[model samples]
Target chain A: MFVTPGYAQETAPAEGELQTEIVHEEGHGEAGFPPFDTSTYPSQLLWLAITFGLFYLFLQKVVLPRIGNILEVRRDRIAHDLDQAARNKEEADAAVAAYEQELADARAKAHGIAQTAQDAAKADAEAERKSVEADLERKLVEAERRIATVREAAMKDVGTIAEETAGAIVEALIDRKPDDAAVAAAVGQVR
Target chain B: MAEDPIHQFQISRLIPIEIGGLDFSFTNSSLFMVATVVTAGAFLYLTTSSRGLVPSRTQSVSEMSYEFVANMLRDATGPQGMRFFPLVFSLFMFILVANMFGMVPYFFTVTSHLIVTFALAMIVMLTLVGYGLKTHGARFFKLFVPHGVPGVLVPLVASIEVISFLSRPISLSVRLFANMLAGHITLKVFAGFVTTLSGLGAFGVIGAVLPLLLTIAITGLEFLVSFLQAYVFAVLTCMYLNDAVHPEH
Candidate 1:
């Protein structure tokens, strides 16, 4: 049965060959499909082995490693750059914070100086006012003492003049001059 | 003539070289395989030659591709899985470049072949097995045995697990192969319809417009599929490798 089937299959391709010849002169003639042809298997396998083997070697030795390295290097470089950028940003943030702090400190120092200058000016004005008031008070006291002395002198002079006038009137009216000691005593008693 | 869509996938021997009775002929598939490597290598070298701290557009794309695979491995297998980054990354770039190149007109799609994809899948499987054995010693068999299994079902479950583990490479390789093959075949059939119909008559030409439009649309979808298939392949490989690394459950 197997022999009969094999013979029938061979005849089928033979028939196909005769028909194929009628259509095209250069027909491959009963070769059927190259893939089905077991005759060429060894050569095909050999070449596949050779080519694929070399291709494998080429990839392992040259291609994959180079590409792998490129990818790895790019990845590392990117990560490094990102890290550096983050560090720089942090530094910038710190610098800004320091600058703001210094700015606040400088403003406070300026305010303190301003307050101290204002206090010193006020103290100086207060001292000047006190000295001027003291000088004026001393001058007023001296003027009062001098005015009292002058008034007392004028009153004494007036008393002496009055006694002299009274003596002259009495001499003219009675033609007799009172005794000088009595006149002096009378003036003193009247005063 | 109904052109065979399968004809697009024929491998023609370009330079027949034999050494020690071995048929090591460089064929169209080999040419495109070399082209895929060269293009991928040039793309990486040119874009990364600058190694700019700030990458250019092309450089960014290159870097994104690297990180894309790296992240997938790390997520699936953790940091320890990074030891297999070169292998996983190589598989991803190779498949991705090969698939994208296949979308170009007249370019051979190497990954469409089962042999090529199976070989890649085998490498993933081998790596898994080798590493699992090396790291975990005989205890790696614990991967096939679940932690919480009833005594009656242990044999059944363990057998199923072993089968599933063994099937990884087949499924992984077939997924890529079938997707590429089916997509390319569909695209070719639709494209063929456009040509065949247009050649018939004016009425046929009018009918051809639909297929033409479909072909264009499918081409766009194919590009997306190409990238997705590559991503799936790489992601599945990572998961498999993860099982190898941590095989407890």
Candidate 2:
């Protein structure tokens, strides 16, 4: 594909101007190094533009988006999973804390119950001991009063019995009723 | 039968189409360009068509390529350069596949041509210059004027910087073109030696083994060169595009 007859002549191997001009160029001597061959440039440029354009369009429209989406989705999934795990750990910690608090509350309630029972038992035992002591003291006082009354009664009877015994002795010995006033005076003097 | 090491670089017209005054012929170069696109496109399309969340072996290749270029661009130019990913990716795949195609016997290597690589390089430069001027305007000139230089040497430094900036396309294009051209030529020469030696009888065949081994080793090296050149091109493109966005420090 020749751009111009002159341009084509440059690469056609020492023909036309090149044949007439100074023994032709060194690299351009024989078949001409093809890369330097200017005639083929137009086609190469055109096809490169076309193919490269198509390739750029295809990649921009299709492949990149797909691959980018996959990576993005995976990153998002991983982040979400990590967040979920953190939340789960926090919730588990909260549950453990709640369980510990309930156990502490139960322990405190049991201690209070035991303290109230011990206080109540101590009060009951104190009341029972006081009542029993009061009952014993009352019985001892009543017994002491009964004994005093009996002793007084016995002392009062002793004068009468002494008078009676003296009269009986006088009556039995002298066959007569001796004077009660005399016996009483004599017992009083002896007491 | 063809023994000329340089002969492999010849261009032949396939479907010669002359429209108006221009020759728009489909050629061996063009055929391989189309082949490069088709091969790359079909591979990506077919592999990713499944859209598996967990990729298979083939699917991983498609993803790896996409990520490789994507990361390379992002790293060079930050997120601002992401917009040019399509252009960079296309260039990479096209060059890489074209180079590989050259390795297949009888297939033309498109990247070996100066015009092809120069045109691609020109595209990158044009985009860089165009975007830089449009976005940064006169401030884009800051790219040539590095900071911390003594005021007296500013002009000298800037001239050097300007010359370097202007030569970016030349260096970039020539790098790919030369590597492909030289590697193919060297491989051809070694292969030619193998054939020429084998024709000299039993002792010749024995001697041919060394060259034949050299050809195989060169072929392996050529494959590495192919991939490396493509990668280098893409990386340089990113750095240039980065210049467009950021302009200077």
Residue A15 displacement in candidate 1 (angstroms) = 7.1
Give each model a TM-score. 0.81, 0.84
Query: What is the clash tally of candidate 1?
Result: 0
Q: How many backbone clashes does candidate 2 have?
A: 0
Q: Which ten residues in a row have the lowest lDDT in candidate 1 chain B?
A: B1-10
Q: In candidate 2, what are the lDDT values of residues A36-67, reduced to their tens digit?
A: 87767788899999999888899889988887
Quote model 2's iRMS. 7.0
Evaluate residue A143 in candidate 1 and report its C-alpha lDDT on the 0 to 100 scale: 93
Q: Candidate 1 on B1-249: residue-level lDDT in tens?
A: 234666557676788766675657788898999999989988998899998999999999999999999999999999999999999999999999999999997788999999999999999999999999999999999898899999999999999999999899999999999999889878877887888899999999999999999999999999999999999999999999998889996
Off by over 4 Å in 1: A1-31, A133-191, B19-22, B150-152
DockQ each: 0.29, 0.37
The lDDT, on a scale of 0 to 1, for candidate 1 is 0.86
